[model samples]
Target: MTGSPVTTENVDPLAGVRAPGDPACDVYLTGTVFLDIIFTGLDSAPVRGTESWARGMGSSPGGVANMATALARLGLRTSLAAAFGDDKYGEYCWETLERGEGIDLSLSRTVPGWHSPVTVSMAYEGERTMVSHGHEAPVSEALPGPPPARSCVASLRAGAPQEWIAAAARAGSRVFADTGWDDTGAWDLAALPDLAHCEAFLPNAAEAMRYTRTDNPRAAARALTEIVPLAVVTMGAEGAYAADGRTGETAEVPAILVEALDTTGAGDVFVAGFVTGTLAGWPLGDRLALAGLTAALSVQEFGGSLSAPGWDEVAAWWRRVRDLTPADGRLAASLDRYGFLSGLLPEPAHPWPRRRAVPTLGFRALP
Candidate 1:
């Protein structure tokens, strides 16, 4: 209702890249949506069995919905593509978003006999673990594909349908997709190859190693080049690396020096920040550092969007680091790579549909 666009596709993430260009939507998420029910003190030292502990009640939209909502708050013309039921939660979701300024909801499809998906989050001390459940519904909402938006960043997890993918590519937009696999015990990594046509393919280093079956991050990143010229692999703490033809490079983004309270959706924050910098014409390493900083701030709070940092906040933090010149190797390196760089190529080769499998989230050592 805030004017943010919305789309819903039945994405079987394991389907290996659903087809390029999904009507040029900004982002597509295919995953189990959850409510993110959390207990503030759950992670704290627990008393014997179930002792009476103090906590707060919170019910908010989560997953890709949560990510898009957060980005909208940062003043972006973001569109969300997902599914929900024609139930009470669905109404609340719509109402809550409507009240929030800076988002559009025209793309939200209300499916009959379906319940809005949710995740119960138990946030006690510093960690949040999610027990997620998805509502089963028919894919009957025949909404038309969206035309190319400003910049498309699609995260294929578990909710979108296959047809939408083809529609997205047809829109002719700057596309980037993160990996999301719906391995409900059925191992299929179809999204990997399908995202090949995107401008950037960002998968965690661990997932790339396992899914691509490669040991080196550079090789894995470059390998993704065949699918899309610029492929990136993010290494938590170590930094993020990218490869594209004779332009292969890696930069270490320094992690924020904050005691992380919760890491749920930290990855999503990183993606949003990175993409924001990219669309703003910032250098890659700077973009990565900005992403890491945003993610670091996210873990210091609870919930998904509730913990996100606005642009001003991020800029302030970056200025502090720059002025202080703290000796953090990773962040310093990222700045060096991205700082004062100009007149770079405007675009990398478009990604061909992926030909390999999308790996599950995990970790991989760098070469």
Candidate 2:
């Protein structure tokens, strides 16, 4: 069944806006959960009717799983509201996300006799193509109660449940909505009105341009500011463009340079970082830069959820460059760009516990 259309009278995203206050959980993510089988390091896609070889292969939970794991690793208390089948894949995802990543899944459900979603991701350098299949439990069945979070992450798609966004907004939860690829290319403007309840509307460059009917990412982001308070257009490799209607300002951040092996789940990781920074009260530029850095770090490793860097990794990277004395001007400028990380990292005197790589990896680092 289709959800009720969003109207201006019903949604005032700013009406609920207040100073950041303590909440039971940091983020509440609602979406599909897919068991992903990722193949990494392919020189190129397979020819039609031919096979291609991959240097590495790994399995991890996909979809919202990527964002959940990323948020947990960044030290956010995240809760997921989604459906999982009562199958082994579903069990694997549950245990991995909850036990391995420290994400709370109490709101998520395990449906009986339903097949969980699964996807096969083909990774080629910084790009990926995926073939997915599965059954998604209705949103009503997945999250029957009001959201218990300070913020929420949802997807903008056809037939999405608009009521959830409305409920979150009514409860003073900041809503962040991300768009997916629309194969129909309709770029449905009808979806824009639904974002009235969202504090931030995030979409990739192509989606932003197509949705706003603009010629470029900047123009698209500016156009989107008319509908939502903050509009972020993520331009892969080119970084992201952000326009804040509340501030009447626009900022663009360049992407971090890294050796990308697989781009699977990079977008989700970026969202995680962006949301984390937003809740932390950072400036828009710092948020975009951190998001870009998070995405860059994710591409450096294999797997989807498994590849997300934890606080330890981020701190380690910051420690490696904090005292660098670059000899060249351009190198110095590049290092200066990352100076924000130094402030964001945890205190050197107090080490935060790291998430386990897997259930059997053991939690402690070797002495």
Candidate 3:
């Protein structure tokens, strides 16, 4: 809320190729949204029986909202389908997505008498511990079908198949999926039946290795391509490696070095970046670079959804890196790697509203 007047004038990454009759939305997704309360500036995790005080705190919509906000801020026309509780928290989340981020929530509905899901996250020593509480919304509240869009991002859970994924694929929406950790410890790929329709699968190094039974992340990425057309394995500090099954192309990009403050939803931000690049049809290496850069930026801030950077932030980061004097080999290499962004970034104008995590939700009325 502390920036220039919030404006929706963002550079459309896909402007040059857009044709008439194209889907109005660039991405479509559906999942639960949680009210995330984050506590930062902690030196270490709290001990039992001790009253701990965090130096900073912030609140924002989380869960699926994290990915939704990231996509919208990147100038993708994002549409979300999810259930909201008829409560103050729900109202705040709804308004933030629709008005603050310009996300289309027409497919979302509110359930009467239901309280919103909430998560309390404590970030310390570059990691986070979270405790969440909420009951599952009734299945009857699920979206009837996926809307036509250029692409859809989905979280694939083992043993639970989302029917809309196949329907969306059949309707010509490219599907990109990421899986949650299998608490059952099975890590069986067959459990994710919806993956058969996905155009790409993105997973962390451990998840990729466990699912493919490979000792190396790159090997896991290769093995994963047997199932999906594209496989991206995020190697954390090492960056990401991608394998395109159809074209037999492979690319690896190193992660950007940044002093991370909180990593609440950095993975979701990474996926949003990849989705933007994929829909815009960038090269595989450029897609991986953009994804890593966006995630690197998100960790420097607090909360999940609000910490997401808009095109302005991306442009600013590009300019900052390009201006460094006496550049070393590493800096020069980075400049060369990200040079593709020069043509895509919008010219600097009134910076897009750069939202940050604030301690309180209540603001005094302006005179």
Determine which window of 10 residues in candidate 1 has minimal summed lDDT. 352-361
Best by lDDT: 3
What C-alpha lDDT values do all the predictions have? 0.58, 0.77, 0.90
Model 1, 61-176: lDDT tens digits are 66666677656544556665556667777766565554552445566576777887777776655656567777565657654465457566676554343555556666566666
TM-score pick, better of 1 and 2: 2
List where candidate 3 sits over 4 angstroms from the true fold.
1-9, 347-355
Worst ten in a row by lDDT for model 3? 346-355
Better of 1 and 3 by TM-score: 3
What TM-score, to 2 decimals, does candidate 3 have? 0.95
lDDT per residue (tens digit) for residues 112-220 in model 2: 8788898988888577889999865754564665456888988877545567778888888899989788877678867455687899988999988988888999999
lDDT of 3 by residue, 124-170 (tens): 99889999999999777766578889999999999999899999999
Q: What are the models' TM-scores?
A: 0.72, 0.85, 0.95
Model 2: how far is 156 from its true place, Å? 0.7
Clashing pairs in 3: none
